[model samples]
Target: MPHPRRTVMAVTSASLVALATLAATGSPAHAVDDPPSTPVPITTPDGALFSYVVNADTRQHTAAVKRAVRHAGGVVVQAWPQIGVVVAQSTNGDFRSDVLAGADGARVESVGATRTVPVSEGTPGSGGTTAYAEEKASGAGRTFDGSLVGATVADPREGEQWDMAMIKADQAHAVTDGRKGVVVGVLDSGIDVTHPDLAGQVDLDKSVNCSDAGKVDESLAGKTSLSGTHGTHVAGTIAAARNGIGIVGVAPGVTLASVKVVNDDGFIYPEYAVCGFMWAGLEGMDVTNNSYYVDPFEYYCEDQPDQYAAKEAVRRAVAFSTARGVVHAAAAGNSGTDLDTNTTDDTSPDDSTPVTRTINNGCHDIPTELPGVVTVSAIDQAGLLAPFSNRGLEAIDVAAPGRRILSTVIGGGYGLLSGTSMASPHVAGVLALMKSQHPTWSPAQLVAAVRAQADDHACADVTGAPCVGTDADNSYYGEGVVDALGAVS
Candidate 1:
């Protein structure tokens, strides 16, 4: 099964109410000095530490909030004034309570810990094995004695890449292979920058790792520290080089930037996500591909103080990025639950022991459910909805090939994988193509064009319940499979 990815808050009822009111209404006026042009990292005390996002009324309130954080025995780790969200850590287990009770808390909107968000790749064996291992297992290289060789092969496997032709990317390439000016940020584990298919296609200058304290560390860019190949696969699907040596991407001409967010253990935290989005906006990236969900809680509910704070901080970061013209694309998840209907979430608080709870539509998958995000579902080779893909008319904005996808992986090899994770990069690549063709178009305009150009796919009658919605729009197919030719033209 697609294991739920793993990875807290303190506030009084009255203070919570006040913060809720602040969220509803605009912040009160207050002034402080300007924040640094770049994020400044602060060290936290040793011990069991917790991450928190302190929402301020204004940039001027940042100093006061910092002071309050210090007085409360907490340390400021990173400050993002562009969205008025601060990343802080403290050994005090009651950091949230202390901040809310302090004088500076009055100037803040909400303070909650940065929850863990794991990058879910769907069921094991669903996407087959890792590309590197698969190639070696299949004896991709055989010596004269019939023994398997460990040497890498230069197989592009172009004919097997049906997903490319399904979206008509090959035909679209003739019209425009994408522009060099356009860039797509792959916000996932990390990319194999040295791969033959992605060597010159990566923009190292724009790439950075945001896996810690919401600070952008250029030194960590393109480094996968772990053995995971998810980020490399995603990057290949988006902008792998068209060197006629390996698999070609939807927009092979566009540039890609690796925004490493997933840690060595394959977990994605809130701080990393926030930093990735903020950095993308600041760098003027045309589109961002989000292949995972922020974890700890699969659905962040408003009734829960900690979950509410995480949602608010992420929502603000996404809004800030979208406003800057970065089109955000995320996976719809592999839970197979209908997002439009009221369903119970049994995998919440994934960082610890998961508790089965009866959750309704009020609880949402952050980023995917947030406003202005381009949510993508998965489809199989025959234009059928993937069994593992989450479906809902309300949350799904588009559909793309995701099952048994063949793409570049680490070690300059190729392999087959599946999940909504694979599906998201397809849409992100199309967005890049569209951006290249229409450089002056806004994010809203690009989204509208993407949805409008899709080829309609009707739901099929299969096991369980039949598909819902009409041909115009449906819970399974969204606006139908994305069309690359249509996107570029």
Candidate 2:
């Protein structure tokens, strides 16, 4: 049963407010210095990776960064605070730029221009750059740390009234066949390359991993983690490569790419995730899928200010990408309470007592809360909202099949799982279908379409008797369950 007392804040409004303010101001509202206009670069002759530290404090140091890049015979490609600037072709291979560098600041941020993986088969515009796959682990339908089991539907599922079967039954209406040319990007763990169900169907030719700072690997390869399977499952749902076996994705023909950002522990540090978002933007991916989010109950209200700051930064990154035409989809979050109002009671954990709920406002609660991103929740096989699914009446824009969802696992076999995590991919797959049909839609337009054509039927009534009827987007079911048929139409 769904836990009624838990409140997860689907706070997407704050994101938009930040974006609007940014646009109006025409500059960043965060604390920091301006980046160098003509930063230099530094690189090693062997092409092997090297590490360096810099001063992240002042203006003269900023000039020093440029001088360092020039002195090293390399050009500054990228620079970020807490992250070092990447330069190419330095004479001695030593580079410095204080735009944000410090002596003790050994922050291993990535720098340098992202390289595009070469294309093998399809036309450039047809599929664009693709994401590849990497190692797979065992166990399906679980969390990255192997700490929890995702939600699943019961046989004839408790919520059969609203299930993927229904979507498949109505697939014809949901998707259209056309030379629309959409490129869907899966930004998660990594795919199960050996899954028979999603073999050749995947466009391994265009995969990339943006986790180690900003290195983009075309093979969609990544370091293995319990969180890795999340990417694989999302990818399978979106395109799975149409090989003869396994299940067919929502849009089997569209091209797919993976931008692995979330680590094995399911940690999506804002800076890293933002870097991935930036790279995808530069690559021009049509739609990007984000299945992971921070567990909100990890921090306290005192930290809310800092949390909002990080969220603002991420929001900037998402807006930066979407402005370039990439669409990002994220989970609403797993916390069962409003992020703004739900504060911990400050009870000390007893010996046998588990840490049931703690709040951490610092982490980006969910990328869903970021601006220009589509926030999704989950639904069950019977068309009822999953008990564990986070509610965001007005905050979430769509919902999808998240319960007992069966998809590719690392070790090749398939498994079932639940959670808004599982539900998020269904929406990703649907976006792929949309891109396949109408590849030209902008991020905002895609969002608008999903909202305008959503099946508001299953939405939760956050303020009523038994809470069952029409109401604005509430905490229980955001925009109700996502109806692919309704959305695409």
Per residue, candidate 1 scores C-alpha lDDT tens digits across 1-489 of 211121012234544554556554322111111111111112233356767778766656777778778888888888888887788877776777678778777767677766432122222212111211222211121111212111223234667789999999888988887999999999887888767777778888899888666677887433434327788889889987666565788988899988887765555667778888998999999999998888656676654556666777888889898999999888988887777663467765555445676543235787787878889999889988988888877668899999888887777777788888899999999999999999999999999989999999888845663578778688887888999999988
Query: What is the Cα-based lDDT of residue 271 in candidate 2?
Result: 42
Give the number of the best model, judged by lDDT: 1
Query: Across residues 1-489, which tens digit of lDDT does each residue of candidate 2 receive?
Result: 222112223334544453345434322222122111111122233343332322222322344555554454444434433222332222232332321133322221212211111111112211101111223233332222212111121212113213455455135323452122576777776666556544444455556665453444444335232254667777766664334344445555566666667544344444456567766677777888887652211231212322332344455467767888988777665544443333342221111122444443322244676666788866667666666555544456777777767666666655565667767766766666665556667778777776666566644343321233254354555555565665455
What ranges in model 1 sit over 4 Å off? 1-47, 116-155, 220-227
lDDT of each: 0.73, 0.48
Candidate 1, lDDT over the whole model: 0.73
TM for every model, in the order presented, reads 0.84, 0.63
TM-score of 2: 0.63
Cα lDDT over the full model 2: 0.48
Alpha carbon lDDT of residue 244, candidate 1? 56
